[model samples]
Target: MSRMNPVLSFISHNRYWFVIIIGGLLVGVIDDNSFLTRAQYALQIKNLKEQISMYNSQYGRDEQKLNELRRNPKAITKIARENYMMKAEDEDIFVLSDDETNNNKENETTE
Candidate 1:
């Protein structure tokens, strides 16, 4: 029999390993639904779950505040006064800012 070339013999010996490496690359990185794509989808799912949990916790806190507002007249009044700046007709609200206070002090000094 004729002697086989060294390159052909080496390729024939490692043919199965070449197929396995090619198959692994296709399944792991080159396929449409690949492992790399699945890992990215998993990360997006994790972030969406975290956002859902945060919104749920915020909803719970808002619900507690609503319940408190509904049950207690003082709490309702406090929310109205602090958020809406509402006051009774008999009460005179003095709204002062730091800038106004500084201007008043400057005017006093000039006088």
Candidate 2:
């Protein structure tokens, strides 16, 4: 009778365990749909949640500004003057160029 090599005998004895472990690893880490791959989806969900929070905060701020504008004529006039270059009939509006604004910012920073 031939004696089996010790390494071969050990491998044969544990073959099922090896297959189960390797198969589990393949399904968990190497498959297209896997727990490891789901980590990316989790990160995407986190980013989307952060964006939703940011948008909600921005919406709240915009809603508050809208309510203020609705209630206050002065706020409406301020927004119009800042955004639309609007002025009263008796007032003169001086529009500053972008270069002038940048230079003013530089001067302020230097000071």
Candidate 3:
């Protein structure tokens, strides 16, 4: 029996716009074709590619080292002696630091 205020009536009648905007935002989030989803996919792909390149470089270095070891018996022996702490029965090994030798020379000169 009473006419509503025009502003209130217009807002009440068009309340669906709020629901439409919220629904559109939700749909965009769920759709992988959206811009944000595409950027995330691209970043993941780039990170995987960088990891692959790093692995390939490390593998290449290891392969080169393996080839060198295969070609040189002396290098293998040196590596074994240095890294594995191997010693020949006939040889006496003394480990000395260059700093100590330098300090000894300096002491001798001062004395």
Candidate 4:
């Protein structure tokens, strides 16, 4: 064979190492289950777990409130007053806006 080029000689000497490096790159970056994909999957799993815990806590709170509503007449009235702006026939509901409260405080301070 004609004299091999220096580049070819180097590559021939380390062909196995080159193959291993390229293979590692392909597996780590190009495959479907790549390192990056696995990392993203792990992050998604972590987020889902957090959502599950948050929803579980919220469910527990709602369930407790439901039980309280079933057992206590006051709980139903409180929920109605707080959430639905409801009141008894004789009760007065005072709806105070923040701006009104602020103006009142400013007027008091000025006076």
Query: Pick by lDDT: which candidate is best?
Result: 4
Compared with the true structure, model 4 gives a TM-score of: 0.78
Candidate 3 regions exceeding 4 Å error are: 1-23, 32-34, 95-111
For candidate 2, the per-residue lDDT at 65 reads: 99
Clashing pairs in model 2, backbone N/Cα/C closer than 3 A: none
Q: Residue by residue across 1-111, what tens digits does model 3's lDDT show?
A: 245587678878887987797778876777668768988999999999999999999999999989999999998988889998788889988887667344434556676
Q: What's the lDDT for residue 3 in model 4?
A: 57
lDDT of 4 by residue, 1-111 (tens): 345787799899999999999999999999999999999999999999999999999999999989999999998889899999999999898997766334434556665
CA error at residue 37 for candidate 4, angstroms = 1.4
- Of candidates 4 and 2, the better by lDDT: 4
Give the Cα RMSD of candidate 1: 6.4
Per-residue lDDT for 33-89 in model 2, tens only? 899789999999999999999999999999999999989999989998989989989
- Report the number of the highest-TM-score candidate: 4
* C-alpha lDDT score of every prediction, in listed order: 0.90, 0.90, 0.84, 0.92
Model 3 TM-score is: 0.58
In terms of lDDT, which candidate is stronger, 2 or 3?
2
